[model samples]
Target: MNVPAPAHLLSLATASPSHSMRQDEVLEAATQLFDGRFPQFERMAPVFKHAGVLTRQLAMPVEWYLQPRTWPERSAVYDEVALDLFCEAARRALDEAGLTGAEIDVIVTVSSTGLSTPSLQARAIARMGFRPDAAGIPVFGLGCAGGATGLGLAARLATAQPGCRVLLVCVELCSVAFRMEDFSKVDIISTAIFGDGAAACVLSTGADGFAAVAGYAEHTWPDTLDIMGWRVRPDGLAVVLARALPPFVRKEIRLAMERMLASQGLTVEDVDRFICHPGGMKVIEAIEGAFGLGQGALDRERDVLADHGNMSSPTVLFALDRIRQAGLPRRSVVTAMGPGFTTSTVTLAA
Candidate 1:
């Protein structure tokens, strides 16, 4: 198969809800909410302290999550916040790219935390003034990897249609998935780290930006579907996080990275920088170990986690924005893991 010319990443932007929660405040809230309810609340509460998250933005106020909410109520909030964030992020991205929504030939929206009928781009079309004929692709279920995956998709689309621009947006309202009724450890851990945010980027075949999509690949482990995902409950979506995540990353991520880079006749040594999803402190460390880097080599990843928490799909894009601001290297690798027990890697060139 012939490879299309790499698509340029013209601009990237991120947005978060107004309400922000400090780590100490989150610990206090978790204690008040889960202390007596969960059997091992005391034993597991410490996870919040070590989550490496200093603060996070929430779609709703912290007090709003204290009350039990039905799925309908949660869905309503998701629709409202998701649209607002998508529009803000998209508009900023378009402005930075010196283009309007109407100039976009394709729109790729990725999310997994909530359900929406018209999809994010569809809902934002009239508000953002995108052309009615623009193609819309809504990708769900990629979980944390959605941002990188969506970027790869948009790049491919732009390459396919030369001179066309593609807009990719990732929005996750992970905070709205909080379950008061579920006393599982996953729920507690998720509450400690998950946040609400959205990120958008413009991609085109033009060479206006510093970064271009070079290559993309993914790896999914068999029989690992239960590792990380949601458990549908009558009240809302419950968190399901398996304990094997860190070890799995250490074991498989390197090999996956080698394969992805080798396909382009490159190797880990050829990568000048690694822009990765900061799943947590431990996950960042694991990635460093996988890449044979120093313990704190992934400072940007840690910084993004500390500032924004884990906003699922949009977290990696936040890291990319920071990397760009610092100054893009000649070659960078963007990777993220998500619910399918899947790892998505995208090689970018400056």
Candidate 2:
């Protein structure tokens, strides 16, 4: 395989909806909605407290999630709210990069929460002041891995054409897909961890700003399709989270990463830091164990999870943003596991 052309990340920014709910507030709502029907629900209630999420922002107030909504109704809210986040994150990223929408040559948009006909970039052309000629590469179904993957994609596309600027945007309205009408453990787990948010990254060979993309690779195991993903539901989208995920990650993640890095002519020992998607409290701990780090060593990952829950694809970029603010390491690897039971790793050179 050809090595990707070197490209610098100009800026990274994240945005969230205004409706905030702390764990206690979310617990109260869950109790109200699930207590009467799920007799076993109380036994599983402890997940909220131990989930390590202090608060999360949702596209709509908790009141809206309590009612039943049709697919059309849910998608309407998704289209509206997701686009607003797309614009906000995109604008902030461009401003931080000292560039405007007109300067962008490509838009790589990633999402899977809800369907939109025109996709976000096309819909926002007028509002965002993007050139009608700017090409859009809308990616779907990458789930939580989209941030690193999208960043890698943008870096490649930007460097594909000299002086080209590519803006990568990841938006997920996970809360909008929360459907309690059909009962399942995954639904409850999704409530405990999922949140609505978006993150954007601008990349080019134009100039060094933050870090340059080195390489990106993915590893997927056979017969692991059931680990994590979404299922289409008549109401909206159903969350599919398997209980076996944390253990699976702990067992396989290290070797998987070793292979990925070796393929790039590097080794795990060469990485100064490992920035991983905080899939959950267990998954975070699993990542630490995979790298032989002591428990709770990934404090920043914990902080992002505590603050934002899991915004799926955008979560890793949030971690990356914090890592950049703290100070970039000489060599860092941004990674995440999502649907396809895949682990995607993107190397960054500071």
Candidate 3:
């Protein structure tokens, strides 16, 4: 059987909003907001300090999250901030690829934190100036798995078109979901780790590039819709982070990962490197457990979590970008778990 040619990744890049907050800063802000309001906040306050995060990037300043925000206001902020990060990341990726927006034939944007009508691709036209006939694909609700899934989708598109340049952008303003009205453990935890950022990559069937897309696969668990996602509220979106998540990852992720790898006709032994979304410190630990790696084995994953917190969908790409910068191994597997209780997996090679 003749194997198909692999799509090549020309370049990868990441971006973050300007408002950087230290973990102590976030902790103090959370204390000010939740100290007297929520009875259990004081007891749960340590979650912020122990989140394995040193700093995070937010589109808005910390004080903005202290006040109540209506859905309309949040939606507007999402549009402005998300588009800015998208353009920045996309430009860097294009530049690193030694190409331009006019050279891009397809654009795939993925996000779940907020909605954008006419999509970010259309909104980015004034800044990017792409060809009029360029394809635009805006995917929503993939949540944290979006980066890996977008990479896979762009690679497949590149494979199909052969010479067409495909740009994949994953942008998420996860900080917008911060809700002051709600004070549950889930709310507190979300405040402790969630941040805003974007990641982008340029791909095509080009012989000269950093890495080639080896394969892609994913598996969504059954009856697991509530595992992790956003819950719409009167004011804005809220987090639906189940307390069972870490345990679930430890219990089930390995078998599912094995199954997905099998779909690509590979095994754990075949992968030389692993890139996973840094959902939080605990989730990173859980991912380590699932893969049978030692603590701190996935240092890039930990570094992204510490520096940027969890930017959801773009997070895995942040980690992948770090790996690419440090230097890639012979083979690598990038994956993330999100709303589908899904594991989006993509393989890359030098």
Candidate 4:
């Protein structure tokens, strides 16, 4: 069952169903982490409800990833779990596309939670028996901006080569960095929000398919490093997510969208589909409220969140995959926010 080779595919490739921890499970875990030191759990009640997050998936079992152990133990677990996630996602995506590894030309990998020299891209290729000439490019430190950034790179390559095939893979094992001992508000929020997941897509310039890559634009906001990023310590990853991000999205994203569309000679009004990342409940609300997008602007986003929590780079890809599977209207604008405090938007003429 060969996937009817399309001209280009984005998030429309096949995706595995996301699994999550139950709500009671999260509350219990939060209780154990913050039960005595911080009474902020009650304060976060409304937030949990408002965010509509009942559950979130973990990259590894919480007990396993959060266990304090020697560096070797930690390294071993991270390596094992990250590989598991990468393989699961890669295989499912390939199967959905009805593709074998040999069909891929270039493998573009994206992730923020784990490190690897050969990277998941190489591992996937080697495990799946891909051709040796299949180039592998690993992108790190992009954080949430990775998916759009990967697509942007793919688009550039496809345009330059005029018929190239590229595989874009994103896998984030965020659970590997979970700090259950921390009761900080930001940490709590991150734990409750972030999830483990990966996504894969095949982008081609030669064939025509369900949705096509139209154009992409990226913008970096200055003076916002503290807005969101990681502070690596010997213990684990300490996430710094500012509360002001929601408002920032409302103010800056509109401007960014305008500039991105102008370069392509299009406007928001002309776009028939929106595949923006669900940064969180607030982030999604900020986008919708500011842009005055109709009710359906976030249909895919809501579905993805309910199904997969926040898989960072993979989240938006999952949303776009759902949208693509629905056979959405043509002319779409897909975007995501990442750590550079940067926003990347891609316009797709489906």
Candidate 5:
């Protein structure tokens, strides 16, 4: 059987905010803010150490999150920082692909941390210099799976259009959602593992590129809406993380991978490497376990987690960038899980 060629990945690039916070520094700050306020502060504080994050980029200084912030203030910061990060990442990707923003035929913007009336792509159209005719698609609520899902959608669009180019940009300013008043365990863990970052990639039907998108598939588990999502609040979005996440990954991810691969008549052994969303230390470990991979098999995932924390939708793209930099393997699988309890997977061929 012969397989048709899929969209080529022309370029990928990632950008982080200027301000950064070390894990220990954030731990101390969190302690100062949560102690005496939340009764379980001391017990939940250990999540900072166990999260496997050494440092993470922030849209603002660490002290900024310590203060009370209203929805308007947080939204303002999200608007400014998300735009800057998106433009920076998109510029780098376009430059690397040797193409201008005006050449893009389609733009897919993925985000979940904050709300924007015009959407990020719509707001940055003029700033990015994209053509007036280019189609803009803004995807939200996918959370961590947005990067892979957005890339898959972009590839599909480029494949359908043949000569057209598609740009996929994912930006998340998870830091802006920090809530001091709601000192739940989910909030504590989220504070320990969330950061601000952006990533962009170019895809086209042209053959000149590092890798081709072989296939893309997704699966949304039934009745799992509460597994992970945002709780709308007057102040800002509150993190809703269930403790069953790691165990869920361990039990369900491999089966999801199998089904996705089967759709293309491929299997786990056919993939030379796996680049996945590094949601956290436990999530990575669970993924490794599911795939029967040895411990620490996902070094790039760990490296990104240590350097940038979980930038929600952009984290998988950061791992993808690292994989490409290290020289892409002949066959690779990119996967990420998000709020829909959805698992998005993309198969790549070098």
Candidate 6:
């Protein structure tokens, strides 16, 4: 028989600023960037300003990243930024789990927006003072599903070893990829949305962790690669988020949920709490509409979205941390969407 891990979520460390940017500031800046290329966006000033985003936090000050020569610097800014987030989050997760570096048998780090050799997990193990021989699972290109996928992999590790302990950290430096020159609809949409942040959790074989991840499912939509991805150009990495995503979620989410639940011998009715990734207002709205959930089903999601925007892989974990803190009834389900037009779901019991 497989033994389940006593995995609990740790305190989340966000990279956004505490002070909210004023609507005027956002519009004035956006207008300056898009005045000629996307003149139509000027009409969206009011809508964009109030579009469910009241405030957000960034890992670094805006000017430090938005400077003219920042992107061209050959200093490998991506790895450093990713390292900062990973180290902070690993510290918090280890503290929360009440375990030191030597106790962890495995380290799984996930990211889609950054690249690093010796990867985040290795650097984290070294900097965070974990044992040198701790196995490292560095997952890249998992996109938004990276967090839950990390959990899924960690759970398997816990199940494999009778007393194994695993740490999963998700870090995204999305702010580093902002496009001021390309003012297309996709650019504007991604700019107004994606934010930088990190979230981490610890899984253990003993029932001493925060909560237990009971089951999970992963699926991808083929032929939909173009729905969302990054394109490499001489200028830099460009984002592509299709307008069809909102409609796709509205139409296919229910079917996906049904399959996800059935795979674990569950149904939506059996789930007491729902922790969903707040991809955006449209994605949340699509989820609510498809699931027929009450208004409150998304209250926490709306709160996170208003506060942090979307931090990619860490987004769903952010919501799950809220659910864990709120002390909601047990038997919850956490779900998220990602590139590959994929969906990931994990069932947990508090």
- The prediction achieving the highest lDDT against the true structure is 5
**Model 3 lDDT per residue over 12-34, tens place:** 89999999999999998888888
Query: How would you encode candidate 5's per-residue C-alpha lDDT over 1-350 as one tens digit per residue?
Result: 95445799999999999998899999999889999999998878889999999999999998788789999999999889999999999999999999998999999999999899888888898898989899998888999999889889989999888878999999999999999895788888998999999999999987568899999999999999999999999898998899999999999989889998999999998999999999999999999999999899999999999999999999999999998898999999999999988999999999
Higher-ranked by lDDT: 3 or 4? 3
Give the range of the ten consecutive residues with the poorest summed lDDT in model 4.
10-19
Summing lDDT over every window of 10 consecutive residues in candidate 5, give the lowest-scoring window: 2-11
Against the true structure, what is every candidate's RMSD?
Answer: 1.2, 1.5, 1.0, 4.0, 1.4, 2.4
**Reference-based TM-score of each model:** 0.98, 0.98, 0.98, 0.91, 0.98, 0.91
- Which residue pairs show backbone clashes in model 1? none
Question: How much does candidate 4 score in TM-score?
Answer: 0.91
**Looking at model 6, which ten-residue stretch has the lowest summed lDDT?**
10-19
What candidate 6 gets wrong by more than 4 Å, as runs, is 1-24, 65-75
Candidate 1 segments whose C-alpha is farther than 4 A from its true place: 1-3
Q: Clash totals for all models, in order?
A: 0, 0, 0, 3, 0, 7
Please give me the total number of clashing residue pairs in predicted model 4.
3
Q: By TM-score, how accurate is candidate 6?
A: 0.91
lDDT of each: 0.90, 0.90, 0.91, 0.74, 0.92, 0.74
Model 1: residue 47 alpha-carbon error in angstroms: 1.1
Task: Give a tens-digit lDDT track for model 2, residues 251-333.
Answer: 99999999999999998889999998998999998889888987987888899999999999999999999999999898999
- Across 1-350, the per-residue lDDT of candidate 1 in tens digits comes to 97567799999999999999999999998899888888899999889889999999999998898999999999999999999999999999999999998898899999999999988889998999999899999999999989878888888899998888999999999999888885887888888888889999999986568688888888787899989988888988887888888988988899888887898899899999999999988889988998899999999989999999999999999999999999989999888999888888888988
State residue 265's C-alpha deviation in candidate 2, in Å: 1.4
